[model samples]
Target chain A: MSTTKKAHTTPPYELIYWPTIPGRGEFIRLVFEATGTPYTDIANETKDGISAVLALKDETATTSGDGNPPAFAPPALKIPGQGKDGKALVIYQTPSILAYLGNKLNFAGTDEAEKHYILSHTLTALDLNNETHDTHHPIASQLYYEDQKPEALRKATDFRESRLPKFFGFFERVLKGNEEGGGKFLVGGKLSYADTTLWHVLDGLKFAFPKELAAREKEFPALFGSFYGSVKEVSGLKEYLASDRRLQYSQGVFRYYPELDRQ
Target chain B: MSTTKKAHTTPPYELIYWPTIPGRGEFIRLVFEATGTPYTDIANETKDGISAVLALKDETATTSGDGNPPAFAPPALKIPGQGKDGKALVIYQTPSILAYLGNKLNFAGTDEAEKHYILSHTLTALDLNNETHDTHHPIASQLYYEDQKPEALRKATDFRESRLPKFFGFFERVLKGNEEGGGKFLVGGKLSYADTTLWHVLDGLKFAFPKELAAREKEFPALFGSFYGSVKEVSGLKEYLASDRRLQYSQGVFRYYPELDRQ
Candidate 1:
């Protein structure tokens, strides 16, 4: 295991994730891309993707004197100058990572309450994401979609009819209730990470549950506009989505399991 | 609604959660307890507990200009301060609240990465908590555990045999591979909210899946030891637990559905 050289200039920290899966990692990547940060996507190729992912899971690598197995799995970020011996600090968990990045890019918010507001919205977006994943893998992530097809059907029925509407309604309420921002973004007037995350979540849900999301989106025009509307107007985000940087969904958190969707 | 008085001393923030349920609120409550901070727990039996919770969650109140709804749920911390109109700042979301307290108390770690390390571990704890909930209500939270009893049984089988061990094992590795404090705590040498959280997670699993957790604890003795050991030694925790502040797990995230636990 040759050590990767840390960029003297910080060089936007290295991101190690599965190349094929656009699951939670996309949240981090989207932030980097949206901010035009220079980040190296080390595992965006199949040849070494699995190995890179497995290395974290490997006992030898994990048990080595590294910092607590990179704080629990991917989408781990390796900051250049933070750990002992200058070893990169690798932290996982999508919402935490998003919050950290939000703090870094000054999108988290100003006060303690607003920061908590951003976090609350972030957690809500994640709750929606988890429900979307459960729609397909309701039984267990250990089992394939085929193995849990029946369970997925029952789960998706509930998710589409209940959870989807509930979460979408919450987001809609957040937008509509945003007296601070005139019903624009998830938080205050600015475009925080929660807004970006909500956009991705909406995109993922729409891709996975087209009919249901489309029907629900009408009530959340501001939310839809935030993503498909004003967000598209951002040059960096527009450029990133059009470029190779924006990885498509293949094996990520929100996969397109057709059997789980409404006809 | 009558306005309440705010504390001037800013002693640790007051955490109001269900006394018996280790639900969403325990994360914040535990951090406060572990840190030996001066705080209050308005658990289930408090004279105004139910009404206080109800008023916070009231749709009318949510739309009103009251302190941002405490992250829209419980496990909220009423940081003693004045809002725009001399109101207290209510911070919500279990992870967000924990992170806020961790930063305030100095357990969140020394840098951006460490703060994130704590954040990731907290999120993982939440994921584990969610899985425990799902084992009983595998399909959806909207459906009662009784309604999904059949699926819950099957899911708990997987949870006990595979998921619990896998997640517990991961934490064991995390504790053992801790380079900073020689694997003593989750991150650094001192105890973190993550460690406190891990203690509660394992304890809840034990209560819910005693037979399974008992058998598995032997393999991960250090993890179990650190959890039970570290928490027991925390200054205020034992008193808090005995004094009715420590919630019993009845209505929280990791509820014990007996049918799911049975073979």
Candidate 2:
């Protein structure tokens, strides 16, 4: 209930993730940036702050402290004064973090029904992100892409031919289906975190599979045209995109490998 | 607000998913069964019920009627008279459906913080389920496992050696950390959907990688011992597991290929 704290309020939010490469942390960041809300990117902004993230993934630790369980991975959020007895609340999973902040910042939706729809769409978009990551590391996340090159090549081919069209068509239908949203949004008329999250994934796709995305752009006009392009112009996003804070895509969830792309 | 309806209500929830396998749909079914709540499994119960599922994923249609967007896949839940203007509310995505049912069935948690944690844990369990599936079809979901057998063996090796322990250790720590849960629940003192969702994943893992799981079971006592053994005895789960309603795992996310298992 302490999350009643509005967007611009005190108790600065802390995002715990890897220091760079825009990884899964970027999904959490886009929601914050798109709402113009101030948050501390703990691992990126503060030196030695990544210790907080390391502790989150600490294998020996039983709990995350302040009555929270240890995170299975990074991209966790810590909100001060929001836990039991008014301690800090820590939550992980990119969609879960987005849901918590989206509701607080009014990017969730108009009502409970809209809220779940937005979360569902955000989750679907994240599924695409994970599949994209698998294209480069099909064999094992612990193994480098070079070691898994043969398998990665096969996975990337299926991803470009079948998976990409399936996901793109679904989102395109969602956009066209929502009368209020027209072609610019996935849920309701306004820019919910679903739109923000999907936009970032699309941007990452362009970066990771430029040739494939370029070839398929005209197929899903709603997704690649209006919904994809106009999202960058959304209120707080325009400035963030032009700023240094919008980290470039490298070897995170998305990576650009020429051989992995359309030949 | 419509979800204010509690368990054992008159709504008679309808679950839309493919019949014959405990796929992602089983996550939704567990919360319903765990609470002794009644729900109709559309594709399984009725003779011509697949029409509803087909309509949900109609690729040509932009909207899924009754003001709902088309689902990206099966395993969608429909709550009649729960949407805008009192229409059937349809939602997809395993975790999203589980959260909705868990809350309605009183299996979510006691407070807002617990609710998010439970959902986050459920997502992690589902992530493990997904990785298990990828091991068999390392190259493409559309491709036959035999065609990808070489890659499957390699991926399965990494999964058994690395990923399984990481997930098992994390959940073990979670069970031990929550003093109130005492290795019986993942969140608070009560049985939650997170517990049910995780219990199923562990069950599937045992089926998929029996040799590997047996080898590693002793390493994480909290998980393989108390937590795994006790959840089956949860109020409604015991009866549900005994009944014919519970489908056997076949060619779903968790598949048993001796060649893919630890040898």
Candidate 3:
């Protein structure tokens, strides 16, 4: 396949996220990587990047103008304008950003039904992501994980026993039902943004709850092995995952709190 | 405006949700109400509705076939087929369902950017909804509100003091920045599904945290009053709210736990 020059020719898309953790930004990064889209990860690039990321949340910031609404949180994207007078559009909300990218990148599905299907899966992945994050911060996001450890243990148990199996089973069903794709991709036969999202969800689960996920691995052979294997084999994604850019899982959304994990 | 015959003329949409609480189903309900779309809240109608709702989660169920995937949770919509051979499309995820309804009901936006803007706002509303839900169930959804009351109190404090104000401010900014609608609606000048969602959010907040919300009511004049007032004035919605069909809020996503609330 010939490489698309759009990444090089067009102004680089700017992503504003926290400097340390991969967090929700990883989902967007996966999309950009899978599609071979060239973009600048702003917070990782400069010493003042965190300040720039926080400024978008500042109501008094200059970037808040030019008909743009202030982003509620990070992982905000700044896509270059089409014309001279057109200013960059800044939008937040992870699912919304992914949908915007999916539309622009043609990874969102082909028809309306397919698009909604992809969306449903993406939102489900996000739900799983939020639940995983809460496993570590069950009380409050502002509170220290140490302070909330007891509640986190309780929350993590329900998450692993109930939520994980439920979500994984749902994805497996989606993969199996995709007759158009022959059970390969999440949506149409072709790989879309939802596949990348599921891949991340599976990856995060494995990282956070290694023994528990491993125990259930045989339960979702298609989701854990085949579907996940396919996403990992995506040429560009394979390379990106191996690169230094793939931030290690730490105190981010999917933290490996050993006390919270179970067999 | 003439009442669109789409409600009665078309096959009624079947909504599969919990029979009791409004929960996330209310968001979808508001869309149908605003557009005058006829839908059967299945769980509320038949004695076997709860069984039917749970059957969707059963992997071995026959209805899971015929090209429909199992729903991850309730508030799943089963739209009647368009053609003789067409199968009823089953979709879940509140945002996705709302998007599907917005497209059919003409509440989504006129252009691509407008559609995305609406989506971004809707997702943010959902975030607020989730946070609000978490205030009552800070530890685990599986646990009763009473079981988590202490942690719930702590979580509710951060939510009311920090998260609620932040989200309300974001909505106000979105309303203020909408040049197309002149701040009358969330996206365009005319009422959309998102406007209904924002109205519900404000209403739920008031119901759950009356004192705190009332104290901050003047802080978000556009969101709390003007925009909300306009949404209430929407002819169809006005009638729907007055009708018994509008489920009273209790022990749902937004609940009135007096001990959890503060000024």
Candidate 4:
């Protein structure tokens, strides 16, 4: 064995989320993946990663950042110090993380109005994501989907028949009205965080409600097909999607329950 | 009738929402009330206000801001011209609106870390709010609460027993860990938008789940009594709460469905 040791480059972002499911971490992951930012996924990289994630919620965990506020939930990011003496920043809340990353990555927006526009879209996408999660866990996240099957059935019905079309229609209108961005992306002509966020939304919705989405495919051809096609073709995102890193949707947000599915 | 006409000061902000119920508008209203900012509550002021609100969603409404993107939903704010030749700005999404007002009102945060901390709190509060809304309208917002009473019962149980405590507990931890702010407010010693937002969350929870919240009152004494008490004592908010402008909780976000309440 060689005595010489190779120098290691610290991954700027340290993502801590449940290793099993993609969940909300996927949103932050997509940003990193699309930008090709090297980051350590704490949970995915080590056996003790899940424990590290859970320890974040513990009030007295013996973690490195002891003084920082404990994240209410996981999918928290530990960012490296910006300056030589700056302290590491641990931030959570999916949209907040995305906004921070967007700012760092320069995909936020060029102008004030554009930034707010992107923020509005990102929040709306999150609203849809929340509703999608509720479709499966309508009663509570603490309870199993099996226990709330009846409630889930009713909630999913509304989600599919009414909420799905309404949300998809809104994005379609956004795409059609993209005069400033030439109708290619949600914000400016170039891809912004909103585009990636929306891409994930559409992808998750399709995974969760294939039959229902297929039934209404023609309604938002520009959004579901053209816009999605363009986003999927982004060189970085394309490679990420094809890689094993893109976890399959299981019991996470946008879960598929046969009983809840409708055409 | 008096012949003399009084000079009118244009309200700097125009808030448009369904007038009969507080709904999400109350969040924005609390910010305005706490700051004593003069604003026009459109739907409450005029019979044609709903028409104005609807026109915003109409693609062919021939509105002044024709090229600007329409709001995805109600509770949209219309900001008057800032400069002599500036055009009005229309923006919506409850948290988005709060952020805009927070920046304009200087209640967001003093520094970058503080701003992101405030943002995390605001988003978490909004998450709780969304879940609260779904407790009643788990099936669909478009459908009547009566139609989803069975589903609502199950969801309300989960919300009361699980979600409520979890969210409140998170806020309590945030309050306890505030060494920098002296534990008086969510962000800093002085009030921020997160403080106002949390006040609404507590108020709405008490209104909707009185028995449950009361039973757990002692658990979050600091949050329920001190933080909430302080926020309520803000002069403008105290007056607003007592005034007729403070709309009652009806079939809105925090409706009191007797059947759904439990200890």
The number of clashing residue pairs in model 3 is 2
Model 3 chain A lowest lDDT segment of ten: A59-68
Cα lDDT tens digits, model 4, B136-194, are 88878888888888888888887888888888888888887775565558875678888
Per-residue C-alpha lDDT of model 3 across residues B10-70, encoded as one tens digit per residue: 6678888888777888888888888777778888877888886887778653234447666
Candidate 1 fnat reads 0.51
DockQ (0 to 1) for model 4: 0.39
lDDT tens readout by residue for model 2, B63-163: 77789888888889888899889998888888888888777777889999999999899999999989999989889989899999999999999999999
Per-residue lDDT value at A156 in model 4: 88
Give the DockQ-based CAPRI class for model 1: medium
Task: Give a tens-digit lDDT track for model 2, residues A1-263.
Answer: 11323444756899998997788998888888877778889888898998998898789998898989889998899999998889999999998898888878888989878888998999999999999999999999988989999989999999999999999999999998998987998888888989988998999999999999999999999999999989998867888888888888887888999999999
Residue B109 in candidate 3 has what lDDT?
78
Clashing pairs in 4: none
True contacts kept of each: 0.51, 0.88, 0.50, 0.44
Candidate 4 local lDDT, A85-176, one digit each (tens): 47777777887888788877778877666676677889899889888988888877888989888878878888888888877877777777
Best by DockQ: 2
The Cα local distance difference test for each model comes to: 0.70, 0.88, 0.80, 0.78
Model 2 C-alpha RMSD to native: 3.0
DockQ, each predicted model: 0.51, 0.85, 0.49, 0.39
* Candidate whose TM-score is highest: 2
- lDDT (10s digit) by residue, model 3, range A1-263: 12567755656688889976778999999988888888888889777888768787786432354566667788788776821148767777889889888878888987766787788889999898988988888777888989888878888888888888878888887777766666569877788888898789889888999989889989988787778887898988998888888899888888787888885
TM-score of chain B only, all predictions?
A: 0.85, 0.96, 0.93, 0.90
